[model samples]
Target: MGLGACSTQGPFEEKDRGPDRPVDTSHVPDAVPRHEVRTAAGNKNPYTVLGQTYHLMDDETGYREQGIASWYGKKFHGRRTSNGEVYDMYAMTAAHKTLPIPSYVRVTNLDNRRQVVVRVNDRGPFHGGRIIDLSYAAAQRLGFANHGTARVEVEIIVPGDQPPAPLRAEEASDAVAIPSGEQTYLQVGAFSTLGAAEQQRERVSGMVGYPVVIHSPEELPELHRVRIGPLTNTTEVAEVREQLRRNAIEQTHIVKE
Candidate 1:
C-alpha cells in the first residue's frame, strides 16, 4: 500500500475556511441518527498516518470521550472521504480515528454547552492529539468555528435515539420577534469633524453600493458617526463587513435601530 501522509487530509488542511460571509446555516439541521451497515471502505484496522498506526474500533458500544475538536471547511470540501463518500463541510459530519465508520455521535461543546449530532463518515484529525474533527457547519453550530478549537464531549449516539435538544436550561429563548421597522447598519467609522467623516464617507461609498451616512448625536455634537446602512439583514452586513475588511477596514460594528 502506497499510503502517504494522512490519506484523505494534508498537513495544511487546517487552513480551510468557509465563505466570506458564511451562509445562514441556522436553518441547516443536524444529522439525524440512523442505523448504517459497517463497511470495509474506511474501517481498515491498524491504519498508518504519518508513521503512527491507529486501529479502528470494533464497535462503538458505550463510547464516550472528551478532547479538543477542530473543524475543516473549503480545503476538503467535495473531496472523497475515508469511507469513499464525498466530504461536505456544510453537512453535519465528523472524522474520528477510532470510531467505527458511519457511526453517529452527539458532540457537545464544553465551552458553550452547545450540542449537535453528527455522522462519523471519515477518519482523521491526525494532528495535535485532537480527539475528533468536525465539519465547518458542526463547528459553527457548536459556536467554535472561528476560535479554531474547542473542548468537547463526544458520545456515540445509538440509532433511533432521539437526539437531545441543544438548548440549555438557563439560556434565554430567542423567540422574540424583531420589532417592525427595525433596521440594521454597519458603523464603519467615527470622527471628530464633519470634513473627516465626509472624506471617509466618500472612501467607503466607493467601496460598495450601500447607502453611506453621517450623523452627529445631539449629546455628542463633536462626534461624527460614519456608517453604512439600514442594510437588510446580518448576511448583507456580513458581506459589507467582509468587503471593508479586505480593504484594511477592521473597525466595524453592527448598528440596529
Candidate 2:
C-alpha cells in the first residue's frame, strides 16, 4: 500500500530520505503468475482500516480495475507486511485493499503503454482516489516513480484451478499432511542480495529457534530465499507460524518445494 499521508509528505516523513538511487534493472523481471494457495491470513471479509470498511472478494477471477496508482518506498522497506513477509520495495509486488493477499496481477501504465506483472502481497492505498499501490521498483519500471502517481490498469491473472479451501485456525492443529510429492515450506523472506538474505535468516532462526535454510535457486540466483522446514504436516506448520507471530514476524507464505 502507498504510505498514508495527510499532505504531499506522507507517513514516514522522517524516513523519506530523498530520491531513491537508480539501480540495475537488467535483472529485474516482471512478476510471473503461478498457481498458489490463497493464504488464510489477511483474507477476512469486511475488514476495516483507518475508519474505512473494505470487503475482500471471495474470488478474484477476471478482476480488473482502472484508476490512480501510487508507489511506496524507503520508509516501509524491510518492514513486516500484512501477510507474513518482509516488504521489499525493489521487488515487483503491490498492495491492494481487497484482492487475495498472495495473488498476481498485471499492472499497466496507460499513458506510456508500459506494462508489468506484480504480485499482490499486502493491502492498502487508503488515500482518496487510488486503486492500487505499486512497489517503488515497479513504479520505476512503469516510468512513474518520479511522478508519484499514474493512470493504470490492474487485472488479476487467475491460475488454472481455484485455490484450495481456506484453512481454519483450529483445523491447523490436526490437519493432515500433504502428499510427499507436494511438500511445502514456509517462506519467510526473499532478498536480491545473499548477505541481506542471510541476515534475515539468522534473525528469524534466532527468534523462532528453527533451522532456517537459505535457498538460492540455480535459475534465479539473484533471489536468495529464507525458508523454514519442508514441514510435512500442517500441525507443525501452524506451530512454527505461531512462533513467528509471537516474535512479530508477519510476512510468510506456504510454498511448494
Candidate 3:
C-alpha cells in the first residue's frame, strides 16, 4: 500500500495533528535518560528499556469492565510509538494503559454488545475516560468505524480461554470478517535505534483500534522488524497491506516472523 492511500482514507493525518493537538512526546521523556547496560561478555546487544519496572499484572488480571473505547487510523500509520514499533492502525490490535504487551483481550461495544478479540500490543488510552484504542479493522468489526468511538466493556481474555465468538461481520454492521486461512504475522518496520522505533509506537498508541505492541529486538532476538497482527492467515495480509499502502507506507514488506 502507498502512504497516499492510507492518509486519504483515514480520519486523521500525520501532518494534521489537530488544532488542539496534544504535546508530542517522541523524544524520550525527561525522566528517562539515555543509558546502556552490558550483558554477558559474548553478548553485543545492550539492555534497552524493557527492564524498567512496570506495574505488575496479577490476580487482578481477569475480565475488565466499562469505559469509553476509541478507534485510530491513518494519522499515525508510520510513526514510532512508545513501545518501539511502527503503528499500523488497520489491524486487529489495540492499546491499553495497563495490559501486558501481547496479551489477548475481548473488547465489546457495550451499546451494541458488538465484540472482537484483540491482542494488547502497546500501552495507551492516556486520554481520560478512554479505556482502550482499537485499530480501524477492529472498529469496523465492532460496527463503529463511521461513528469513531463507543462506550465499551473490555474483558481480559485469558490466552487459552476464547470468549464467545465475537459477532460476525455481517451480524454486526456489515463490517468485513478477517478471512479464514493459515495463521500469520507481518513485519511493518524496524530500526536499529530503539528510541526511534518507540517514537513510532507512541504515535500509534493513540490512533489504533486494537492491541498494538512494540517488541524488543532483545526479546525476539532476530532481524528486529517491527510487526503488526496475529492475522489468522495469509489471505488477510492483502487487506492489511492495502491499509499500509493507504497510509503512505508502501515499503512495508511482509515477513513471516
Candidate 4:
C-alpha cells in the first residue's frame, strides 16, 4: 500500500477473497539483520503525507510498542512500496509510520500470542489508531487475517540481539531491573527556552513515570536539555525511546553521566 494514499478498498474486489488457500509459508522467514547501506530516497528525514509531517527514526535499536495493527492485501500487490521494492502480499514485510525503511521488527499478536518477524520496507497505515501495517501473508500467519485487525506488540530486532526466551508464568509478572551502577540517561530533546524544556519534561515524565529533568550545562548555559533517566540500562533506554517516539519525540542522545 502506498503511504501517501492508503485506501481500505482493494482494486480487485472479486478475486481478493483473502489468502483463503493454504500456501507454503516455510519460505516466508523472519527478517534477518545484515550490513545494509541506507539510501536517501525512501529514508526521508521528514516526509509529509495527507498534510501531516512525520520524522523517521535514525536507529531502530530497542524500539518496541503495543497498538492496533492492520494489513494490506491484493490491493497493493505488485505496487511499489515506499522503499522502491515491489509490494508482495505473500512476503514477510510490513509498513511502519516512522521506522527506518528496511528495518526488521518482531510483531506479536497479543490476543493469540502468535509472533512473526517482518521486514519494514514502507511507510503507512495512516488511518487513526493503527501502529504498523502488515502484509496479507503476515496477517495470515499471525492469525489475524480473518479479523482484519489485532492488538499487537512490535519490537525492533537489532543485529546481534538474541531472540527472547519464552517467559514462565511467574517470570512474566516480574520486572527486569537494571544494576545500580549501570544507569544511563537519554537526552531526548534540547531547547534554548526553559519553558519549552520544562513543557517537554513534564509531558514525558507523565508518559514514562521516570524523572524527566531539565539540565542546563555549565558550559552551555543557554541550552536546556530535556533528559529522561537514570535509565536502568540500554534495554530501558530503548523502551523509553520507543515511548517517546510514539509521543512524537524523535531526536534523542544517550548520555552516560
| Number of the predicted model whose TM-score against the real structure is largest | 2
The 10 consecutive residues of candidate 1 with the worst lDDT sum are 167-176
List the candidate 3 regions with Cα displacement exceeding 4 Å: 1-56, 163-257
Q: What is the Cα-based TM-score of model 4?
A: 0.58
For model 3, what is the C-alpha lDDT against the true structure? Answer: 0.51
| Backbone clashes under 3 angstroms, per model | 0, 5, 35, 0
Q: What is the lDDT of residue 221 in candidate 2?
A: 64
Residue pairs in clash, model 1: none
* Model 1 error, position 202 (Å): 49
Candidate 4 — which residues are off by over 4 angstroms? 4-27, 163-257
| lDDT tens per residue, model 3, 143-227 | 7766767888988765434443353333344334444663345555554345666766665444433344555644433213456
Model-by-model lDDT, in order?
A: 0.74, 0.74, 0.51, 0.73
Model 1 lDDT per residue over 36-64, tens place: 78888888888888778888776677899
Question: What lDDT tens digits, residue by residue, belong to model 2 across residues 1-257?
Answer: 32232233332232442134455332456765666677766576787777778888887786999999987777677776677677777788988888988888889899999998889888777767888878877888899877788999998987545354365553455777778788677888767678888899888888765578998877666568789988877787888878986875645777785
TM-score for each predicted model, relative to the true structure: 0.59, 0.60, 0.44, 0.58
Better of 1 and 3 by TM-score: 1
Pairs that collide in candidate 2 are 84-250, 84-251, 84-252, 85-251, 85-252
Poorest lDDT segment (10 consecutive residues) of candidate 4: 8-17
* 1 versus 4: better TM-score goes to: 1
